[model samples]
Target: MPVWRRYLVRDASGRMVELPSRALDKAEDGTSPIPGFAGRCVDVVAAVLVAERGQSPQVAEVSFTKLYFDKSGFVDTGKRERMIRLMLESVADKRLARIPNAARAEAAVRAGAARLQLADEFAWQPGPAEMNEVMLRLDHRPAGQGHTVH
Candidate 1:
């Protein structure tokens, strides 16, 4: 008799059967939802952001893939997004003023695993309370483009 034994598991229907590790990995309890960059939330966030900006969807997908999709299935999209927002600076009036230590400050807030609240009108604009202290400058749409703030 062979010394090695076949491993078996019970299915949801209460049936005992032998399955490969790959199948086991796909089981309800075996898989855990990935958070951030490459997860479901990232797709939603990217989709909303691109659409709101009237950006090309193809470019948005390619950009998302390039930034988050690597060999592994893990990325912290929250901190990445927050850092990008925090690093935003104004480039208007021929002057540039960056947020002071934006990365460190945002990182402290984005360290935990919290679910992002998505909605029809989801917007993530980082800025100062006073209008004059705005760190970033947005470009005006071309003439007749009819740009509307969401």
Candidate 2:
């Protein structure tokens, strides 16, 4: 059976909007306008999930990442930089080690960034080189302790 996940986008006022699975794909194409800031925020969250889980971009996942990158633009901006800093800090927290997997950490980063209205850049993108870097870094750490990259 196919699994379906409910993705939520929240406005500045914190009202949640549920997006259809199809919307995520459209957003990735860059053809459709992002529904709104909230929807775009949710898309970032989904992308983080996909990256951390090592999953291929399901239509929903790619859409979220595309919207996030498009709106937030790249780093070199204060907001995006701060978001990455915050994400790194969160990954270093001891409490995160108890969580067992990267997916939860990714979700937390996404939610926290949304709450802070932080910009989302391609900082989370994991290419082969990036993955290799991550693995090398993890190899140097104690077993079962690795920084969250997404």
Candidate 3:
């Protein structure tokens, strides 16, 4: 027995495009260019639903962290400080708890920097990050028309 499902998504010009089952069923989000971060951050989500390799979910977080925080093994010293500052500002503008699981990687960078900083390079453990993900699920409701009582 075979079950066939068709996914139709609106494309860039506000037109609906039929998506192949291969794109929908893949583990990847179908829009991510870097293949990590769970496809939740605005930067990553710009593409939306990217394909995923075998990389772990944390690859984007750690990769960007390293790029921003670490010297990157080069003498240039990189944009670490500026990146950290932007993160601090972004967190201030956005509420971490409100960002949702669909965008975990971006939310963490923007809101969870402090936590991620503590985790740092090679020191990050999945426990706290995982806990936060679970918490994001709280108070969730299916998106649709709203009902109001006067």
Candidate 4:
């Protein structure tokens, strides 16, 4: 059986927020409009979930690492609309299913980014740039201080 990896982040109240494992995938031709890291960042994922629930995105001080199942799994990057829709449909929390589409979810991410006070450049989307900015913003302690990611 294939090992499954689960990406996750923490809310302001320190609650774990789960995110879609493979939110994007590379095209067969090796060119994807959306970068590979889009939708895979734990902070952005948590922000999307919180914003979807109409709550604040004051996420906890967790960054730099995303969760994985059994310490191993696959990562796909491509057109992510379908996966986002599927995740919304299948998520255990019905509240997060209210966004209705990936675009809305992405909007929530942007809103959450604004709430978090990220720079305008990084706040607009979910990609390596945003991830790096968020990680730098949230990474207050040393690498091994907070929750351990595996």
**Per-model TM values vs. the true structure:** 0.17, 0.30, 0.20, 0.20
Higher-ranked by lDDT: 3 or 4: 4
Ranking by TM-score: 2, 4, 3, 1
Error of 4 at 70 (Å): 30
* Shift of residue 131 alpha carbon in model 4, Å: 14
Off by over 4 Å in 3: 27-150
How far does residue 110 in candidate 4 sit from its true spot (Å)?
29
Model 3 per-residue lDDT at 70: 19
List the pairs of residues colliding in candidate 3.
29-49, 29-50, 30-49, 30-50, 31-48, 31-49, 31-50, 32-50, 40-103
lDDT of 2 by residue, 1-150 (tens): 233543444346534345554665555454454535422333232322222244432222222232343452221234445666765654453445566577667767666665344334433344565345334422333346433443
Model 2 residue 67 lDDT score = 33
Cα lDDT tens digits for candidate 1, 60-108: 1101111232223343445446444433321121122354566545543
Better of 1 and 4 by TM-score: 4
Q: Each candidate's lDDT (Cα)?
A: 0.28, 0.42, 0.33, 0.38
lDDT score, candidate 1: 0.28
lDDT of 4 by residue, 1-150 (tens): 222333344445644455443442222223332333333433333321112234333334332333221111223322233334434443323355565688667666755544344332122344565465455543334455343221
Task: Output the better candidate (1/4) by lDDT.
Answer: 4
Candidate 3: worst-modelled 10 consecutive residues by lDDT: 39-48
If both were scored by lDDT, which would come out higher, candidate 1 or candidate 3? 3
